[model samples]
Target: MRTLGLTRTSPVTFEEAERVVDEDGHGDAEENPDGLARVYVSPEVDGWTLVIGPWCDPCDGERAPEILRLCTELSVRYGRAQAYYYGWQGDGSAWLVVERGAVLRRYCETGEAEDEFFALGDPLPLERDRREQLRLSLAAEGSGDAEFEDEWKWAAFDLAPEIAEALGVNPLALTAETRVRGTGVLAVTPHRT
Candidate 1:
């Protein structure tokens, strides 16, 4: 057992976890502050165990990308661990398994690895302008009372279509309310065509 790729020597602490890896491309860990986390990879499976501060959130602006990087590195070094990634929701953070630029699966405190949710690939080149516009507009809405409602409306109407195209799935059709649900958008499997 060569210890797959990366492994944790001890219980990874928050300070050690946020010490920063490849900072130039991933940005500063301090930027994420309380959200810092560490993933220890074992050489056997390149198995990774995530350690985090009690307040980390995977969806937070700063930490999400770092978590993404950890997944990317794991996939690259280990081929693909069935464990994918693990996050502790008690800490408001999560881990996922990404391969070849796509989030293949995710693992939470729950026992199983989930596949229903995944990233929709990179944004379409043409949608760059539109996405920026939406981002700016949504930023203006900020955390106002109406922000949630307004943002959902904008995403459904303005952003979903482009994102759908980028992901090669029809957003309108993926929801259960849509007739095409379960027909078009498919879980990409190793063997499925």
Candidate 2:
């Protein structure tokens, strides 16, 4: 089964998203040359997963809104949350960070050293300063300064409100913890020490 888009007329959940995709036969098994099979929907600890085949012409524009809506619902229910989108080409993947029903940030790594960050809300200028400090720290740790050169890479600005209100801490005080994940990409875990 294949769904062109998620219906916004009603609430959506991870299970519901999975059911829609499965019922539509979108999850049919197919051989993957790169050894990574396409995943339509799967359960995750933080939220649900959606994998779009690289050849799916409408996946990015049409299906992404539905996924984001489902993710937003999950975030509202689960406090801090995540909704992941993985494209089975060129190391395409995106992590949607949500907290208290708000989308705080989007962290994406499409290839080696091809990292992107996007902030969604207004925070104080101090947050930007703190983020710059964190970027410098990441650069010093060998993640490369180029990753921080992009404005979107400064995700801390978007996360500052949540950090200050929900987490109850200063963004500057949090220690930067970078790690290599299963995808063979380096990312800074969005948690404080």
Candidate 3:
């Protein structure tokens, strides 16, 4: 796994990362004392995980473009890379797998993969209905907070087939063999096989 342009200083415990994220509202946006970007490590189903920019605010509408630009820059620097952005609001999110600065696959709500949710050829109407049902279910279950809502949105990329299926997206299509590149900005362990 590559660091993806992030600077890894001292190791941080998941508890500490969670605390900082809880206080600051973002894990990847902050800089360390040396003025380098900080990457947080947390536990994941596969193994430990490292992630940046799970930004969850609808107010940050400008962030999408910035994230895209950053993705482009990172792809240029790293050769091949994948980027995913989730929008908490109705705008939906985008997933891009790029290689050598060219996008191998681009998936989004309004793109070629639009109907490829949870299942290939899932009708748009059905997808919308299922998403609405999920939203309502989350609301009723008292998981309507911004954080959980953000989690719900990002569940589309879950490595688990059953989880992605529950979210109305095909697990096989969602899988990617992404190599870690760049500095220390990105890396997932144990790396997805």
Candidate 4:
């Protein structure tokens, strides 16, 4: 998927989510049904509210900071917020975990050696585990930076979904059995173009 925000403390209502998205006061959150540059806020799916759509994708390098600000804002109100990104056509991944307006951890690896627009925080537990596992397996077979890079890179690709599933919800695995609380809604993100 592109990118989305998930929070444990969902806003009490769809209106609340819309309000967060309509910060610029465009009044476009009034159910326009246009589907252009809108943010789709899930209705407490698996106890987490997910914010998704064009205006929230931090994968766009130029908009990373602004998108992160938006996610942090959500966390401030909701207690905790997470943003995840996976490129649609290539090998790329990123994730940010925020709690109460503070960035707990952020990681972005898109094969670019110099991209730090989103990378932050120490490696999460799962990341550390994978690194150790790969190290052991590689050591047994004799490894180089290329092999290490190949295996380690896969860790980034798997992180967003793996961490989501382990910590709370996995967007890619949501299904009818996912125990949704209410129907989701689509609203225009505040910074929508």
Candidate 5:
């Protein structure tokens, strides 16, 4: 496969994986128990697992909120935690990395934590488009209370539900009640098919 214009044909060694992980601004490896698939999230970010999806299902959407609710609870008692995810495209599987929570950095060779890494590409414009669409949608919904603070808080809540809830409003209603003027949640709800 192609990686930064280079073609590779083997799996990445633990060393290679660690390099990529570090270059992407992930914290040091000693902090990671698993090495490759493991990421160094801050205690706050560590508190949640942003659920990707079960496309076309609002229940999947509901699940994200549920996770936030749980994380909120966990954060209160357990402090915070971290989690990881990988991509599964069509049928072929391979190595990749979740960069800055948006772009994917696909590896040229097979590797462990195959589903967790995403190949690199433009993530910001897409996120911008999504925020615009969401803004318009929320406006159409007659919720003019749109604001970035809420979106940022929502993102933290989305990532760590237990922390969000522990601090009120069940997740479902909170998200539904919330609207966005600007967004801080980088990961979008995966496309529903």
Candidate 6:
């Protein structure tokens, strides 16, 4: 619900992935099942390691710079990394996509508008499609105004889960039907202490 992250990997053992979580640890790592504040690294679920926590939150304006840098580092280490912050409202949602250490896309919504810094790369295909669909819908009502202008921003709130599904996995949609291997465990970020 807070944040979700994914990295394309091939049979990476939990120990191997745990190293990244403990990379900057000034304190020993602690495993917690709750995964509330700590990073919860889920075993390969449909081929992704779910990095869940505030550490991966992508829409925090104050933390955008740090989050970007961290994702770059993670992608470099893991080959690919993606994260999302799904706000409870139809605003403040964000998602990031990285491949082979380069950021392919990064976007975040700030209420009615978007944070320019967090807006990187062209809009993803689905984003463009979302706006277009809304355009036609608005046209049907013979209307286009504030909603049309901010469609891209608020649309992400609806599409975050879809985007996650398209690119990899949606942490929120995990079910018994989902393919899962091993177990998810909490890893304390070194910066947490």
Cα lDDT, all candidates: 0.33, 0.38, 0.38, 0.63, 0.28, 0.64
Q: Name the lDDT value of residue 55 in candidate 6.
A: 68
If both were scored by TM-score, which would come out higher, candidate 1 or candidate 3?
A: 3
Question: Model 1 Cα displacement at 95 (Å)?
Answer: 5.3
- After superposing candidate 1 on the true structure, give the runs of residues whose Cα lies further than 4 Å from its correct spot: 1-57, 81-95, 105-193
Off by over 4 Å in 5: 1-59, 82-85, 90-193
Error of 2 at 61 (Å): 3.4
User: How are the candidates ranked when ordered by lDDT, highest leading?
Assistant: 6, 4, 3, 2, 1, 5
Candidate 4 per-residue C-alpha lDDT over 115-144 given as tens digits, one digit per residue, 9 for 90 to 100: 454567666777777778766343422234
Tell me the number of clashing residue pairs for each predicted model: 8, 5, 13, 0, 25, 0
Worst 10 residues of 2 by lDDT: 184-193
Report model 2's TM-score to 2 decimal places.
0.34
Tally clashing residue pairs in candidate 1. 8
State the TM-score for model 3. Answer: 0.36
- Name the regions of candidate 3 deviating beyond 4 angstroms: 1-10, 26-49, 55-60, 85-93, 106-193
Winning model by lDDT: 6
- Candidate 3 lDDT: 0.38
Cα lDDT of model 6 by residue, 57-165, tens digit: 7767556677777778778877888888775455456889988888898877656433555677767777767777766342422133555546544565667778888
Q: Please provide TM-scores, in order, for all candidate models, with all chains considered together.
A: 0.28, 0.34, 0.36, 0.69, 0.19, 0.69
lDDT (tens digit, per residue) of candidate 2 on 13-41: 43453444343334342333322222333
Q: lDDT at 128 for candidate 5?
A: 38
Residues 6-84 of candidate 5: C-alpha lDDT, one tens digit per residue:
1212333334533544443233334332222222211112223222112111112233333333334444454542222
Name the lDDT value of residue 111 in candidate 4: 77
